[model samples]
Target: VLDRIYDFERILTRIETGTVSPKDLVALRESLAVIPQLKQVLSGASADLLHSLNDRLQTHDDVYDLLCRGIKDEPGLVIRNGGVIRDGFSPELDEIRSIAANSHAFLQELEEKEREKTGIKMKIGYTKVFGYYFEISHANTKPIPDYYVRKQTLVNAERYITPELKEFEVKVLTSQERMLALEYKLFGDIRRQIQGHIPAMQETARAIARIDCLYSLACAAYDNRYVRPSLNTKATISIKDGRHPIIEKYLKDELFVPNDVTLNHEDHEILVITGPNMAGKSTYMRQVAVLVLMAQAGSFIPAKEGSICPVDRIFTRIGASDDILTGQSTFMMEMKEVSYILKHATSRSLLILDEIGRGTSTFDGMSIARAVIEYCLKHIHALTLFATHYHELIAMADDSPKIKNYTVAVKERGKNIKFLRRIIPGGADRSYGLHVARLAGLPESLLKRADVILEDLEKNGGAPVPAKAPVNPAPSPMGDSLFSSPVIDKLLSVDVSSMTPIEAISFLYNLQKDAKEGSGIQ
Candidate 1:
């Protein structure tokens, strides 16, 4: 519907001024053609807005049919150059074109008509002396028509002319000019006819634009397997197996792990997410904002299931960028945005704050981050997703039921680590900056020196990293520890002691093959 919308505005304006070109006229024809399709697309839609728009849509079938036959498919740009109008549209235009294109045929018909009228079998000829004349042999005894005025006399033949012949000569000579003039008139008449329906067309175009937006949203929903979230006035945002709409598009089906979020007005009001860098902290916060926005905007969200509450406003402080023109540093912009959030944000709002205090010294940044959290808990009390590198923020979860701690799970393989990209209930104290540096192509010697320095700092009580994860911590990946499949589950449940030796062996072999097949290990 919105494919060629770029040309519609100018086309309508030109139609009003009576100067629309044939190329632009084709655009109008295409717009008129979409009316039926629009009606069909919105045929059974239950939305009152869509139904009203459908009602407002006028089917200008006559205008469409006229334009289809009036203009050439591929016409010249300028109307005066001719070839703009198709043949057989206007009888007068077609006749003028015939005269210009078939002058010789007309002359033959003229000679035949004179022969029939006078019975002389006169032949037509032309010369430099006289333009066109009829010749008759003197040997013939038949008398020439008295209406033929003698033009030339010869020994054995005589040439004469008629008023009709002279009239045809003038017409054949000036046919090109007359044809161009008639084509221009026919094009203008068609343009005028279409001009009267400009208001209807403009309304139809607006309808198409509206449909285009909704249709695009629908396409996104269908392509990404997005579900329509149940919207309510309640104070909870619960989603099961939720996904980031953008991140999932480019990632492999199994590679992108889905996480669940449950935020409400009371127990789980503020979620404190702690994770290492490049672990999707910001992505999770943004996903919530985007999903909420989509639900409120009447579009589907990328989640297996969703039930969302409408937020009055969604405030975000996610990325790090400076306003160089305003001479504002990253920290200054961060404070300003947070100030605005605190001032305007209400309890029904959603606040997505990421790394609120990393712009200054440790004490100052931590102090500001803590103060913001306290303000959220006491005064503002918004449904917030606050992400931070300050691990001390996790201690707030113990004191307040409104706060909850979440971390990104990972798998440590000797010196290498893989981000599980799953958010679980806990906190992570170690940022693994050295590991990330090694992954980023840092020199091995520098990594070794940094590790040594980190060890010294930990020993000296500067940055306290635990020797292991806390007791009964969230599940972290281990090395191939009983990878589960249907075959494995069956093997665990089956009573092998009752089976005979050969039967047991056969069952084991079949189970191995099934496991391999299930794992896609062809």
Candidate 2:
């Protein structure tokens, strides 16, 4: 019924032209027909909103009844055809239809009887120029009756028409013509009668549309176990155990870990989120934005409990996207969006920024990112969720009470790291980009070389390490790194089982000699 209801405004607009088509009128009737069912559906609801919507709706059975009685059950797209109006609705129309139906039936009977008697297999046919006649093929030499008056001749057959058949043909053709004209007139009357109820029906359409939206929202809330988030006009947002509405839905065979978020006009205005790649930092930030928007728009949120206030607008600078149409690089687009946000955002606005100033050189990117964060904290003061890999900026949180440091927790297990996907207090100190690459299936040889380079960077500023330490150091829990030095690395790489006794003696002599001299150990 809802699908059948066409645009009510279209009906109203068309009536100004003085007539509505049968298709439009049928659509209008369906629009009215569903109103009673809608009211009944809402009748048992306790919500005053649903009750108010139900009150706006009425049965409109008068319109439905008029249409049911006047129009054909399967009234086609046109009114000019004869079947558009129901039979027996009009006495004159029924009389005309009866004449046409009975005439056609009689002609069929006459054709069959003559075929049996004459055994010529004759068939009744009609033409515009030749009215009605019986056709017999040249192959049939059997005789026809005396009443079969000659009419016309074909190249291979005889054509004849009985006086009785000729009389009924006139009645059939004329009644059919009158029947179509009458149906067109009757369909017009129905369309005009509906025009009088256009205002009421359009109002009801609005009510039905509202009810449909609310009902769908209710169903989603019930099915997804969504909680109702409280909404207010203040500039505070606090959500406990908040899950990403979208990401949680697609997590197969694994559960989504929900995180808590808190933001206010003052102290907790901006969050500097730092975490390793794929640690759910982006997911966490986006959920805070999504939940706030949902709550403000009167929707239940995907959280245990939340209290959100309406923001003037929500601005985002998320992920890597280039505007190829305008020849803008990803960094250029990032800057443009950030510029706009900084220019317009008020304290009440919400901003979800992921990796701002990430597309340039490391120092430049870090500087720009820091400047942007500072501007947002001191100037815009908007509620912000800023996710970045730049651990250097975590210090900003220490300086200002408005900015707070948060990280998605990570756990190191032996040589591998596991992303816990939990956001907690304190900033992440390392990115673990190599670990993420390992998970993404980088070559082991390349990863080993990269790990060596990273170790060098952290240890000796990427310079070549000497053979060994100048002095002995304490043993470590981290798998004997002192013995795994460059000299020891070569030692471990050798196949000791394959070495001859003489070769093993030679290798031991070289190591002892290298250990005595500072550079010989290499």
Candidate 3:
């Protein structure tokens, strides 16, 4: 019924136009006309909430009747026109309009009487620049009547104003002006009466908005075959046959493969998901988070069966983005978000950290990923889904019983691989990055070169270090070459891991100064 309500916003806008339109007045009347029916239906509803809402809605009968009797059904757009007000709404305004209607005939009759009295070829004419004037030929100026006062002189005639003409002009113009003024005044009165019901209308609007949102959600769930999930305070989440709601909604050909997920505080607090790109790692984690959020929000989840632990907060560090203008690199931004999660997350929180340390070198990133997983398991104990391509993180499960390893299953065909899109209890054997790269249209020669590098690294365990470049010979102060000094070499080789951030900065500054001084470069 609320959805059927039309032109409410347009009516409000026309009120803001100050000089309200007849069409807008009629629109407001139509909207107000629906309120009585709405209130009656709501009042008769069996639900207590509906009954209470009905108590708050105003019918505004006086305003409605005023508008219905005053404004015409098809009142034209502007208010200045004479037909804007109905005939019987205002007697005084009607009388003024009647006088205005006969104004032309009255002026004609007065012109003829004046012409006979003056007898000097006088004629009455009207112009916007000069209201009503009597024109007398210049040849008859000597016999110009004393009653006529010259207003303007033309080439062959003198334009003159008479007291009778001025009085008639005031009566005609005043009547038309007052009629318009009265119509505007009546419209304002009706608009203000409607404005008085604003508080009730606002309340009704809020209730309708909430109802509309819930109805939309229910419709979506029904159309997509969703089920309601049970929510609890167990600090654990378990879902069976879960699928990504949005992805499933848009899938055209192949059926979306559903996956299962389990998270608890004691044994499986952290699931380190490892898989090749596009193998459904991110999608699975996101599905779990979405189901939990939906359950807590009192909406159905897109799953066969599910139970959610009501999470206090959900922290997602999913995508890669940076604040480059603020001088924060991508890695720094990632670390900052990580820091925020660590500081704010509680045991009851849900954390979805995807590619946590991916913005830096492999070893540094892997090390950070390991530390974050350990901290979440040992300190926070939050139910966390940590998805990454850093396959080495799977090793954390061996030492920590709270950590679990999961992977998206993949099947390899001759030179091509198919993503199974299945989550299972085990670490991924290997990331098929090369296969993904090939799929991404990498050149065959580049793929072969990468294959050679991978084979060599597999044989040697790691890349071999490059040989150091020869140092440039230069003058040194302190009676010795700085590059050859044992003290300088030891200083350069000191363990930086033991230094704090401030201490490291100071050490770097002092080292640069010392090198400059020793090389005699000032």
Candidate 4:
């Protein structure tokens, strides 16, 4: 009931805000009513009942009709005729009928009050075998006075349940004490009749519930102006410069700056993105993550075109904060998370780690970052995106075969920096912190001082440079030159392959001494 009411409120909001099309609203209404019909059938009938009646009643609509009539008219008829039944007729039958009739009336009234409180219109339908029931409405009518807005507000404002209403409910129950007792007796018989069909009834209920859930989710997605991504696997995550769905929709005209990112099993296994603060790195990552989640949950994504690899698990280590209560520092928490990923991530997993080592000092962070990249490259093989300010981490791709590096491009026009918000191959040249500081309303003198400090730090190698080379470089003809350079001549001349293991160790020690003493030659 709560879910249905919530869905109805969402639909109403959309209709009022012009976010939902009339056609969609009609479809939503129709879809919303399916579950109630399913519940009615599942609640009242047994599997044998359904099987026996299957040929006679082929459609869900038929079942719905039966429930509506059974609840509304049949029970009353049985109760009214109970007094006139023949001598051989059971008196309990009439008494059961009366209880059912009263219960049905009470339920109907409750449903109406609920609809009024929720601003969801309900259509009551009937049939035989199925008890009386109401649908939470998918009906459309010609515009009536106070039709959309007034009713929506009333729906929003009306209390779902109040103490006064609870009191009235108690009174209703007290007044129907005898009928309730009789109904409880009849409920037992009904349960027995339907016992054999429990599985079928459960299946029917599940199907209806699923339909209801899907419809409600779809309606909510549509109401929030969520764009439906095509359910195909073209390895395309194309949102035409679209904004983050959640952020953009709520903050109109604020411009979410859509981006396109694609990752598949083939060429695009990993994405390494680098950008300045507030340039949408986190937002973009989150956007993709949310889309993947939405898709998996059987929802439409907010993108122009999105084709996703159905990932098994999504691991995110994005934001930074200390657990003061737990007395764990940010770095400790990060390591804890990273350890889990390294241990558990599989080939099908998707990982997004942002500023992974920022919780610690530069050297420590960079070293840990290097080890992590190497580990990911060799073990725990998964599609990963490591976003960081420590550009030195990108160098892992040089030695590791599986790693890749990418940077979010930024445009610098003189003293001004324009965040392009474009992801490209290679690492970032600088963090551009000072430029960001200026943008953050820092004083000109302080900004200049920060720039001077930044330049000095760069000169002294305090800041790491971005990766400009291809992460997955092709094999070079001169690969052997790296090992055979003049610096290692003494080590090479030792001929360790010809020596026994013990002798080889001695030779290596001697070669290391020779090299240290500058006796090694090209």
Candidate 5:
């Protein structure tokens, strides 16, 4: 049984790697399901061989049957020494000969009796090669030669008769010819039946392939020391030393770095991961998602013996892109994804949001990020790993008991950043974007300019503020016109502190419209 499981694993790996199609995977799965039942009938190595043969036979039976049905009309076809034989004398040849002779004689007598009663002249000829003889019953009795009887009987280079038994031979040949034609009709019927059911046959084959794939996956999981992780009605994800199987395989010589993460019903439901760019935060989040999926799908996960409370759904919002053609900025796309996750994710779900709200201005992005964390904590109640550069979010751990803060550790030396790629219990010091920029080949002059701009921006309270209006302004009708539009009214009514990330977006759009309409407020 264990060995069978191993075989099943290999089959599934092939499927995962695209070496086998889904149809083949289904067949393999069905074969694995039968392995346990077949174990009792054969023992030891014999059992293994039998199981292997059964799998092959199940897979190839359709093709073999199609070929056999094509030739069924040729009556002499039979199994000989485990191989197919067509029309050759054998040990059972005498018995077949007797049956053919009797059949022909009966037909000949019937023909003669009918002709006598009707006053119609009829001629019957029999031969062994034709399998039966033919009966001629026509009013125009043309001169029939000896060669005519022999020529009609010959088919595919085999002689129909011997001279010694030529008379009987022609009669038998005629009868055989009639029988063969009838057999051919029956063969056509069978072929039609197969053709009609081709769709169903293909479906069944695909189903079997899926079964084979499952069996193989199960087997491989067993071999790799993989086990089914636990799941509960509550939302919780916990894993120890879990490695991403695909990434590990690609690394080849390098050892895979393992990470441990835990989200539970009591202590923590949300984890805010803050780390420098490229420090494995996203990879860690993805690993957890993949493990949950694997466990729910009934396959062993790549972990050093871990347990997970089953997730109803998995959502990942990891990358950034602008919808320029759609007239949506990068921030709009980010808000759209964030809104989707918050709306759809449930307590039994797992959410991975990497760098959410990073596309907007610092204050707006930080405010939006704060509200998102709060919503997940207070409303969705799902297990979440929120990876971000917003260090302010780390404070949520102090305020909310359900939120825990974590960071992927990075070693900083003077002006350099060295990614450790290991998760640790704390918050990140900074985003280190400049260090990464340097590594990306940013010119020294550009870095210097960026530093100068950063200093000026920090001195002016992080962002530029408009100069205050003159104290002695008396409002005219035109000045009042600046703030009277519907768009401006809606923007003024929006309260960012109270609204979630999604609501803030609607407010931002209304504000933008107000600005476009010659409103004074920006």
Candidate 6:
């Protein structure tokens, strides 16, 4: 019933302006009539908010019944019309209608008598151009009655008006016009009375709106099997069996795998998650953030269990998107989002980043990612979840006490890979990017070639060098020769900072010449 309330302001406006239609009046009455029952139901509510709203509600039974009795059961739209008001509402209106009914019968009888008296097939007609006139054909123009005054002439006919007809038209039109004026005045009075109660109706509407919202949230929790989460101010968020609320709902055939998350400002402020492409690292990170958001919003969280310290802000840099019209590339947009997060995130904030710095080359991207992780762990101390393909970043756990390493588990068959979607302790040993590519339908020849190149890279500690390419140049003769010079030893041991600029330059020039001569290069 509360949810059914809409367009109430429209009703109040129409009533205030004396333009209240039958439908608006009926809707208003129906809404007000439901108030007493609504109050009764709310009075028994367990929540204090609902009970308080019940006390604030005003039923206004007088106004409700006024609309019920004063207006017809199914009144027409216009109030100036007679059909708008009920028959018994006004004695004056009823008497006028009775006179008008008798007048209609009288006019019909008068037309029949005139037709018999003249025997010229006379007809009674009314039109806005000429009211209550008798139309006669031209062939019957002979022996016309003088009492019938000619009013209008047509090509083959003539129209005439009689004094009796004129008097009857005046009485009928006068009564109808007077009755309509009375009806309009009466309906306007009733609408004005209802308008006075608009404030109370608005208040009731507000209370019902709040109740509807609460009911909707409750329904979501119940239908989705969510549990209430514990909240505190301790700067920690921990959840057991946490699953992505939205993803889990859309999943078919396979159930979502739940994972555990733990983060605290003191010891484990930042968690570095590494795994293959589809191993659920991003999903696990997002689940933690969602649970935190829900708990802060005072709604039940979609987790088996959760206890979260309220975060001041939640920031995410998860997916890749470009603002093409705004002239920002994907990498630039990613950096902009990262910059905002780093600038605003506090110790009580929750930050979720996925594949940060992945838009650049391997070495540069890894370097930047490592620096960002260090900054967050050392300076911000925010509860952070970072999912990345950079497995080397997991080694930061050895240096930073607040950095923890975790990985999504996977199973490797002989030639196939299976994603377990489970977060486990420690860094992932391998990334399985090629396996993911294979799953994505990469050609077998390409996969095999990639495997060979990867083997060469591992052997050479970098990208593979061509088999025909010359090996590393023999050790530089300058290395052993320069070491044998006493001047070199002296130069290495000297406090160059203490020397004047000229003296330092002179020493450097002589040393370079001697080193070149000693190596037999000059």
Give the number of the best model, judged by lDDT.
1
Among residues 3 or more apart in sequence or in different chains, the pairs in candidate 3 whose N, CA or C atoms overlap within 3 Å are none
Off by over 4 Å in 4: 1-205, 216-243, 265-267, 463-522
lDDT of 6 by residue, 1-522 (tens): 664555566778777776678778878777777777788878778988778877777777888888888888788776756678777778887877766778767777988998888887888889986888899988875689889899999999999999988987887889888878888888888888877888887777677666677777788899988899888678878898888889999999789999999999767788999999988988898888888887887788778898889888999998989999999999899999999999999988899999999998878889989999988877888899998898988889999788899998888897799998999989987789999999999999989988888888879876645664467868686767777857668778889889999999988898888888878886
Per-model TM values vs. the true structure: 0.68, 0.70, 0.70, 0.51, 0.56, 0.69
Tell me which residue pairs clash in candidate 2. none
lDDT value for model 5: 0.65
Candidates 1 and 5 compared by TM-score, better number: 1
lDDT against the true structure, per candidate, is 0.86, 0.83, 0.81, 0.59, 0.65, 0.84
Give the per-residue lDDT digits (tens) of candidate 5, residues 257-321: 88998998577788999988877898899998888888887678888877777777899898988
lDDT per residue as tens, model 3, 427-506:
98678889999999999999997877777766876676444466995533544545657547868787899999998998
How much does candidate 6 score in TM-score? Answer: 0.69
Q: After superposition, how far is residue 302 of candidate 4 from its true place, in Å?
A: 2.9
Candidate 2 lDDT over 1-522, as tens digits, reads 355456766676786466666666677677777676767778999999989998988667878898878876577776666578887789988888888778778788878887777777888998999988888778986667788898988899889988877877877878878888888888777777877887786777787778777767777789888999887677889999998878888999789999999998778988999989999998898889888878877789888999898999999899788999999999998999899989999988999989988899877899999999989888888999999989989999889999999998999987699899899999998899999999999999989988877887779643665453557775443333435476677688889999999999998887666554533323
Please give the range of 10 consecutive residues that has the lowest summed lDDT in model 1.
474-483
Error of 6 at 55 (Å): 3.6
- The digit string of per-residue lDDT tens for model 1 on 30-98 reads 877776876887878999888988988887898889989998888889999899888888887787788
Candidates 2 and 3 compared by lDDT, better number = 2
Decide which is better by lDDT, 1 or 6: 1
Off by over 4 Å in 1: 1-24, 30-34, 37-54, 77-82, 107-192, 206-224, 322-344, 357-368, 374-380, 398-400, 456-522
List the lowest-lDDT window of 10 residues for candidate 6: 1-10
Stronger candidate by lDDT (3 vs 6): 6
- Please write out the lDDT profile of model 4 over residues 1-522, one tens digit for every residue: 324322433443443444543233333334335545444554555565443433232223442332332222223223322222222223654544444457557556766875676556654443343323343322424232232221121222321233433444444445455444644444333324334433443444444445556667778677766666655444333344444667876766455566777665455556667767867688777877888788778787766766666777899887877787989988888899999888888878888888878887889888887777667756766777778787666666676545567777788888889877666678876777777887889999988767777677779778754434788887654344435456477565666667899897877676555554453333
